[model samples]
Target: MSPLLTVEELLALRSSGSPRLLDVRWKLGGPPGPDEFRAGHIPGAVYVDLDAQLASPGSSEAGRHPLPTAAAFQQSARSWGLNSSDTVVVYDDNGLLAAARLWWLLRWAGFDGEVRLLDGGLQAWKEAGQPLATGDEPAPAEGDVTLGEGKLPTVEVDEVPEFVENGGLLLDARPAGRFSGEVASIDPRPGHIPGAVSAPATGNLGDNGRFAAPDVLRRKFGDLGVSDDRAVGVYCGSGVTAAHDLLALAVAGFDADRVPLYPGSYSQWASRPDTPVATGPTEPPLIDAAEARRRVAEGAVLLDTRSPGGREKTGPIEGAIIVDRDNLDAEFDFGSAERHAEVASLQTPIVVICGSVNGSGPVAQNLIGRGFVNVAHVEGGAPAWHELDR
Candidate 1:
């Protein structure tokens, strides 16, 4: 069954036997969700407060937006009249960012029946000329659905360090700035987990505000060293947006059952003085186009991280050792055995280049982790090099 439903499909389902519609519209540091729900929302949709019902209060121990107890979530579900048989559909204006959280939590809470995201969200409904209801929605009948322990995987706060140590990949889904300790508006700390790779959640999205194509997402995760073989886990500012990454992982054909969420994320990690934190860039420091060019002149290896398709589309830079970012560190014949030996030796300076820092950054960091010294990625990347060249 599809994990998503179009507005037209939802309307057809609504006419037959209405699915339990949840208006999950919300924003970080914005006005209350209920206020927005009252102004206008999908007809028969119940307003679910992400802070109130979906999560517990903020605390130093649990971090902001801690998961609600199973009993508490079950009670909240009953209040919303969610039944074992009923299909639940959640939507938000912001491209299923918040909606996916609810979807994930429901499955985590042992919801066996269908729980889907409304594709493209409320805008998709409005764009389809569907009507919305204003003012408060009426109370629903209490449900009899029983709740159970979370079936989906979870990595507790204490387990994270060991997880990373044991060859597991701990992916920090926050932006590069937050990962680099630039500015932390919400959490107390400004850096990422000591060994986490910076795999920003926004990287999963397309320019159209929807998820990127499956192949694109697959390459994106692959670039970060997340494979079906590797043990992968994710975390963000709170547990909310982290689900977005988990969902993206599932959409990219990863088994959602294996991937776990570190609910505490940076918020809890930062609050605890005992936990170690790493600051500054996770990848090799970025160099500008001119600097990259100069380094190339100085006999540094120009490592192009763009995919074969990406390189073909943009045209290749001359004299580059093209190792697609997705296949970083994987054994491959790049030109010849001697060229491979040179990279494997890690003695020379390697200037990694991609279309943007987002793609190149992790690969550079991956190289550094493998004992590469004097490694740097192109700052603004290939376009920056092109500009300077022109």
Candidate 2:
């Protein structure tokens, strides 16, 4: 079954009410998901608390977002009105990042019915001019779905070393910074599993915040060494966003059943002192302000990702190419007639700078994922560059 449902497909499905709709909106920090759901949601969509319904109480051993027991998940599914043979559609505001968890869990729990993510998620729905319903959905009829465990393959914490040793490609789905030990926000330690390749899940998305085309994803994974003959595994800070990578793989025509998930992920691995954590990208992808200036002087394209107001406030760098940071993919799409000619070649030396590293880092990683051969971000972004000049 296809892993995603377009908004038009969902609109047709909604009229029939044949599928169970789950709003699994969540973010790492900030306004609560339930609050957002209550404010406005797809009609008949039940809110699913990622923390309460989707995950078990976490420990250092199980990781931050450990899978719930089968019985627990079955109960939660029932509450959401899942039926034995009903189709299920899940969505979130943040692309499919949060919703894919529920889709993977449903498959993992042995749901025989089709389960798919709403492509591009809530934003897509809204952008299509679809109407949203406010307030809690009416309580659904208790469902009779029976769930079984181990429907999907998984790698336990102890099996990580052996898996990597035996030639399996273990992909780290966290942002590049976290994988490189440059930043460790929630994990017990920085760096990644010894032998894991950095493949941030966000890189799976196009500029529209939807999963990239299957061919694009196939090339992306192929670039990272994924192939039919090789075994592959994926993990993130916890187990959650890693599923996003798995979903992208499925969309890219890989067998979803064959690839395994490391449920404990880095959180569990890092908590154990016995585990080895490796840091640094194979090549340094971050450049200092001076290096960025030098590269720009030598004809490298400097991408200024600051917003219009921000650029006005900070004063634009004379020769920088200003593109909408949120829409970088469109700007860099070489196949499009609208593609930027200045950095049209994949081999072009591209330096990205934003207000700070927080904005620039992911953009740099994203470009690299999109097959750009030479990409880097200013370590401290525009402010740092200006400070260095001073």
lDDT of 2 by residue, 217-262 (tens): 7856875779999999999988999999999899999886788999
Q: Which stretches of candidate 1 lie over 4 Å from their true place?
A: 284-390
Which residues of candidate 2, in runs, are more than 4 Å off?
A: 282-390
* lDDT of each residue in 121-203, candidate 1, tens digit only: 88888888989899998899998888775689999999999999999988887766677776654677678899888777766
Global CA lDDT computed for model 2: 0.85
Clashes of each: 0, 0
- Residue pairs with clashing backbones, model 2: none
